[model samples]
Structure formats: structure tokens, C-alpha cells
Target chain A: MTGLSFRYGERVALDEVSLSAEAGRFTALLGPNGAGKSTLFSLLTRLLISRQGQIRIAGHDLERQPRAALAALGVVFQDATLDLDLTVAQNLRYFSRLHGLPPRQAEQRAEEELTRLGLWERRNEKVRALNGGHRRRVEIARALLHRPAVLILDEPTVGLDPPTRRLLVDHIHQLCATTGMAVLWATHLIDEVDPISDRVVILHRGRIRAAGDVPVVLAAAHSDSLADAFRHFTPESPPAQEAC
Target chain B: MPWLLALRGIVGREILRFLHQRERFLGALVRPLIWLLVFAAGFRAALGVAIVPPYQTYIPYEVYIVPGLLGMIQLFNGMQSSLSMVYDREMGSMRLLLTSPLPRWWLLVCKLVAGVAVSLLQCWAFLLIATLFGIELPGPGWLTVLPALILNGIMLGALGLVLSSTIRQLENFAGVMNFVVFPLFFCSPALYPLYKMRESSETLYWICEINPFGHGVELIRHALYGQVSWPDLGMVTAVALVLLALAVRGYDPRRGLMKRKGG
Candidate 1:
């Protein structure tokens, strides 16, 4: 998708943002906190529609063919969307059915996706019983059940431990490598970006500060480390209390 | 297929949530049951009953109040669902649902329909229990009550939708109950007829005439006796349409609902 924009009243959330994820490539939508990454996801996924720009998923315009575009994309939201009262299998089955899969096909796919996420054994467990990491895995599995050509994860590892986060990121990298599906993984964590498989886009205060290969983008600021590169783009600002 | 699936998913989630919270279901039953068994029994002698149009012969006060009790449960459930929606919005699950590819209006309608279905189920269950207490309507009247229940469900559910969209947080919901629910219920023909009020005060009669909730209660009242009132239907339909439109507008992203979260 290119040139997608959004605003909340007078304040802009995304300003003429442009990026692309070629098939089989993993693209990390990196930014600092409050850098409009979540807003961009809201725009691309049709949570908040903006008439000022265009978004195409797998060659379909979102506004003209929202269902077709949405069907082609799978998303794991930052928050756990699984119904806590439902079993993992039930949750996945519900999503599968929502995507128009037949009941038999949906059940089989739910099982397969759960197994893929190492959640098959816990399929019957209610989401309330699962830990934070396990619940996130269930969400990822639920997203993949429809087998979309593109996967979008918004801060997928926000609450996980370091090892679990690395494992989740590696799992996503492997999925992209094997399926040739495009991936847009949004996160503030600099270390999550795979130097080989992903391109990086840095957003600052609703604007893209840089976009390109991770090494090249990081190199532009005379910084070898991704963390330093991120700091270079985003500097701490003094807090100003609004006049009463 | 997608629509059916979406409907099922939304409805299933609502039912599962309701089932998990056993207290809510029990409260739905107990609240109306208390009003029927205790409150009604206490007031039956003090409250005089006149022959209303729905009554062919002189019916007891307990039988006359059943439809109103049903309306009360539906209204309370509707508001309860609104509270749940507000809580979901605060908890971020609402964003998950809104992000789905379905049209915003369709998703909202599905949510309202889910609430309606839950309210209807509770209504039916209450009725079955009430039957055991020797409160019975005409055999065909039960069939007639279906349409009334559906209409009342939509009206009340639409009101809940409006509240969910407009209210910023679940914590502020008490003000809504105090300002909206209490007044609508008391001013309406649910507890007493308009003519009964006209005897004592003209203002009360006027308030009942304009109270849309009264039309909903009257719809149930007439339907329970195998009667259909065109005026009540018209008023309920108009109110439902207006409330639903306001709710859809209130939930529109550009205006606030979702955007207000950051603020």
C-alpha cells in the first residue's frame, strides 16, 4: 500500500505514508511509542477509513473491494482479541467461519493452525486459562487460519519475555520465508527486525523519518547500531503543560 | 455465508459471555421474579385494576403486570449489554471487532441483534417460570407475543447502542440509568395507564403519551392479549429508527467513539 493517510480531528496520525512489502519479504514497521504505527494499522485494515488516500492489498483497492482486500490479509492485533470464554479451538473456528470457510474446512484449518503455533494441545482450554504468551500464540494461530497472502501483526510481542519474543519473531520469519507471503510487523523494539529478511520504516510523530533496508536506513544516520539509529531519528522532547 | 458467520460469531460470543456470568442470568430472572412474586403480591390489593382494552373480562392485577415485567427485563438486559459494550471498548476488544472487514453498520446491527436474542431468551425463560406461578395468557397470545418481544427487543437494544456509542466510560453509566432509564420507565404506561394518570395529573398523562418506552410496553401489553395497536407500533418503529441512526452516527470514527480512547 502507498500514500495512506489518516487524521484524528485536526491532528494527523499518518501523513502521506508510503511503503511496500514484496511477496516473500518481511517488512518491519518500526517506530517509537506514539509514532502512528497503530494508526497506520487502523487505516490499512479499515478500522478507520480515510478518504484522503488509497490502500491496495494484493492488488485490490480497499475502498472499492474491502472484503476482497481483507480476505487477502491476516492480522494479529496488539491486544488479545480471543474471547476468553471460548476455547482456543472455538475461537479459531469462529474466525475461520467468519472468513467464509466451510464448517468442516474451518475445523480442520483451526486444528492445523493451532498445531502450527504449538497450541493444538491447548485447543480445548479457555483463553482465560492461558498465560500472556500462550494467548498471543492463539491470536497468531487464529490470524493464520484463513491462510491469507499477507500477514500484519501490530506489536505482536509487546508483553512477552525476551526468549518468547525472539521465538515468535523467528516463527514469523520462517512463515514468510516458506509461504512467500508478505509480512508487515509493527513494533517499537529495534532488535526484532531481521537484518536479512526485513526492510525497516521509522515513523516519528505521524511522519516517516526513514524507509529502506534496515542496514541502509540505519547507516544513513552514521550509526551502526539499530538502537542508536532509532535514537538519532527520535530525540526526547521536554514536556510542556498546556496553559489552563 | 459471511454474514451468517459474522452473525453467529457475534451472537455466540454474547451467549458465552452471558453463560459464564451466571449471576447476570440469575439477576435477570430474580429481578423480574421479585417484582412479580413479592412486589406484585404486596401491591395487588393497594393498586386498583380497571378493565383495559387488552382484557376481555376482568383480569387480575398479577396477570396485567406480566407484560410490563417482561418489558422491564428486556430493557434492563438492553442497558446491561450497553454496559458490556462500553467495558469492551475500554478493554480494547471493541477495536478488534471494528477492524473486521464488515461494514460498521452491519457489525453494530449484529451486536444489537445479539443483545436482542439474549433478551428474548431470558424473556422466554422468565415466562416459562412465571407459568409455574399460575400466571397464564391466552394460548395464541404466546405466539402473538413473539413479534412484540422482537419489536421491544430492537427498541431497547437500539437505546443501548446509543448509550454505548455516546458514553465515554462504563463508570459514567449510573448517570444514564438515573436520567434516562428511571424516568422512561416511571413516566411510561408500564406501571400505570395514561388514563389513570389523567385522573390525578395532566402532566403525567402527557409524559406517558410522549414516552417511547411506553409504546414498547404497550406493544407487549396488547400483543400478550392477542391484540395489535397500530399507533404503538408506529411510535416504537419511529423511535427505534431515530435511536439507531443516532447510535450509528455516534459510533462513527471521525466523530469520536474510537478516537476518544487516546484523549
Candidate 2:
């Protein structure tokens, strides 16, 4: 999909924003606060409808085939979505079932994914007892249980420590590399957008200020650091909520 | 397939949560038991039962009102579940369920079914206790009450779903209870039959005739007495469908019910 735009009343959240994360690529949606990154994620995931633009997930038009589009995308929401009352295994099993997995396969997949996340030891523990980082791992594992072609994570490492964040980002990149899946990872942290492996799309005031290879975009602005390039392109005091 | 899975997932989540909160189950059972045992006992001498339509011979006040009392428990539990939905929405969990790759209608139906299941369990438990208090129904009344409980549970749960989706925040729920619930209960034929209301106020009797809660209570009364009131059943079913449709419409993302004030 291309040229997707959205507005809240008269104020715009995305102004003719066009970007794509092709298969086997990790696309980082880089923007400062209030730059409409979350709004863009909302459009791509079909959480919020767009009157001005469109989105296509895994070759399926979101508007024309919403269910198929959603089915093709595995999303780990910015906020925690785990059922706090359920065990880790129960949570994954339920999510797998929601994706139409049979009961036996769902349970098997749940165990396999939890084991991969280093959470098999705590599979029977209630989600409420898990620490924040572990809870995030559970959510990530749950998202992947469906095995979608495109994985979208909105601010997945928001509350994690630096080491934990790096681990998650590495894990995501490795998964995309091995599975040849497209990934749209939205975050405000500049360092999280790797200069070598990932593409960068910078959003500023509901518009795409720059979109290309990470180093190329930064070099075009005559900046060496991603953070400096982001500040230069995304205006201060943006008129939107972007604390993703 | 996806819709079925979504239904099962949401219902399973709700059931698991309910099970974990043991106090909530106890609280749901205790509230109605108090009214059935204590309040009915104190008021039995003051209130006289006229031969209601479902009644063949004059019944004691406690026995006559048991069905209504059971309906009240389910009704309140439905609202309580709705209250939790609102709370969950505010806390960001309901969004997960809503955004699943399933039809919103199916997700909602699952919610209604889960609520009805929990309500049915509570109804049976309440019936067993009430039977111990000499408030007994026909031998096959338990069999008949199943359908009645299902109908009433869906109707009440649908109302709760609509209320939860329409309300923006949790703080406004109390006002909803005070404004919407108390009037609905007191103005219905739960406490007194329409014929009894006619002796005091013809206007109220007319009001009771139109209230959906009255139909629900009467449906339960008919079933508990081994009689079928097809009209009451039809009315409750129609209301349930209407309410469920509205709730689905209100929660649609194209016109999200969670609009902010002055937006």
C-alpha cells in the first residue's frame, strides 16, 4: 500500500505518508514524540481507519480484506495485552486458538514458542507474577504463535532496560532474517534503528520527512548520528500525540 | 474458523478471570441470597400474593418471588460483568480482543455466552439454596428453568455490553447504576404482578407491561412453574437481539464509541 494519510478532525496524524517494509527487511519507523509514528502504526494494523490513505499487509489490501490483512500481520501492541489471570502457557494457547490453530497444535506451538523465548521454565506461572521484561517476552511470543508473514511491533521495548532492549531488537532482527518476514518496528529511540541492517522512515508533523536506508537518510542531512538527523527533520512542538 | 477461535479465546479468558476471583463468585451469590432469605422473610407477612397467571393456587410470598429474585441476581451480575468490561477497556485489555482477526459480532456473542454461562451457574446454586428454604418449584422445573435462564442471561448481558461500550470511562458507571438500574428494577413487575400494581396505579401497571425486565422475570416465573409463556420468551429474545446489534454498532472502529469529549 502507498500514500496512506489520516487525520483527527481537521488536524492530521499522517499527511500523505507512504512507506513500505519489504520481505526480509527490518523497517524502523523513526520519529520524535508527536511525529505520528503510532498513528502510522495504527493505520498499518487497521486499528484506526483512514479516510485519506490506504494500507496493504502481505499483499492484501487492508480496506478490501481487513480480516485477511489482520491475519497476515502479527502485532505486539505497545501496551501489554497478556491475560494477567492466566498462566503463560494458557495465554499463548488462547492466542494461538484465536488464530485458528487446532487445540493440539495450539498447545504444541505454545510450548515450543515459550521454550524459544526462554519462558518454558515459567510456563505455568500466572502472568501477573512475571516482571515487565518477561511479560513483554510473553507478548512477543504470543504474537509469533500465529506465524504471520509480517510482524509489527509498536514500541515493544519501551519499558525495558538497555540490555533487555538490545536483546529484543536483536531477536527481532534475527527472526526476520531467518524467516524472510517483513517487520515494521515503531520506536522513538534513535539507537534502536541499526544503521547497517535496517531501513529508516522518519515521520515529522504527520509527513514523511525522509525515507530510505538508515545511513543514507542520515548522510543526506549531513549528520553522523541518527538522533541529530531526527531532530533536524522532525520539528519541535509537533501538534500531535506521539509518545509511542 | 477464526471467529470460532476468537469466541473460544475471549470466553476462556473471561471464565478464567472469573474463576481466579473467588470473592467475586461469593459476592454474586451472597447478594441475592440475602434478599431471598432475609428481606423476603421480613416482608412475607406484610405482602400477600394474589393468584398470579403462572400460579394455580395462592403461593407464599417467598415462594412466589423466588424467580424474580433469581432474575435480579443474573441482572446485577450482567451489569457487574459490564462494569469489568469498561474497566478492562480503560486498562487497555479489551482492545486486544476487539482487534483480533475475528468478526466483532462473534466476539460479542462469545462475551454474552460466557456471561450467561456464569449467570446460569449462579442461578442453579441460588435455586438449590432457595429450595432448602421451602421455596420449591415443580420436579421438572429445573429442566424448564434452563431455557429461561439462558434467555434472561443473554438479554441482561446484552444490555450490560451496550452500556459498557457506550460509557467512556469507569467513573460514569455509578451514575449509570443510579439512573438506569434502580428505576428499571423498581418500575418492573419483579416485586409485584401487573394485576397488583393495577389496584394501586394503573399507570405503573402499564409501565410494567412495557418493561423488558418484567418480561424476563415473567419468563423465568413461567418456566419455574413448568408453564410456557411464548409471548414473554419472544419479547425477551427480540430485546436481546436489538441490544446486541446496537452494541456491535457502537463498538465499530469506523465510528468508535470511545470518542473523547469535545473532540
lDDT of each: 0.83, 0.82
Query: By summed lDDT, which 10 consecutive residues of candidate 1 chain B come out lowest?
Result: B254-263
Task: For residues A154-205, write the lDDT of model 2, one tens digit per residue.
Answer: 8899878887788899989998899999999988887777789899988777
What tens-digit string does per-residue lDDT give for candidate 2 at B121-213? Answer: 788888888888778679799989889999999999999999998888899999977977787787777777778788999898888888898
lDDT for residue B214 in candidate 2, whole number 0-100: 85
lDDT of 1 by residue, A1-244 (tens): 6777777778888888888877888898877777888788877777677777788999999888987898898999886777888888877776775676777888888888788888899989999999999999888888887788899999999878887888799989999999999999988887788777688887888778888897888789788877777778777722211111
DockQ winner: 2
State the iRMSD of every prediction, in order shown. Answer: 2.5, 3.3
Docking class of predicted structure 1: acceptable
Question: Least accurate stretch of 10 residues (summed lDDT) in model 2 chain B?
Answer: B254-263
- Give TM-scores for every candidate, taking all chains together and pairing residue i with residue i: 0.94, 0.95
Off by over 4 Å in 2: A237-244, B258-263
The lDDT of model 1 is: 0.83
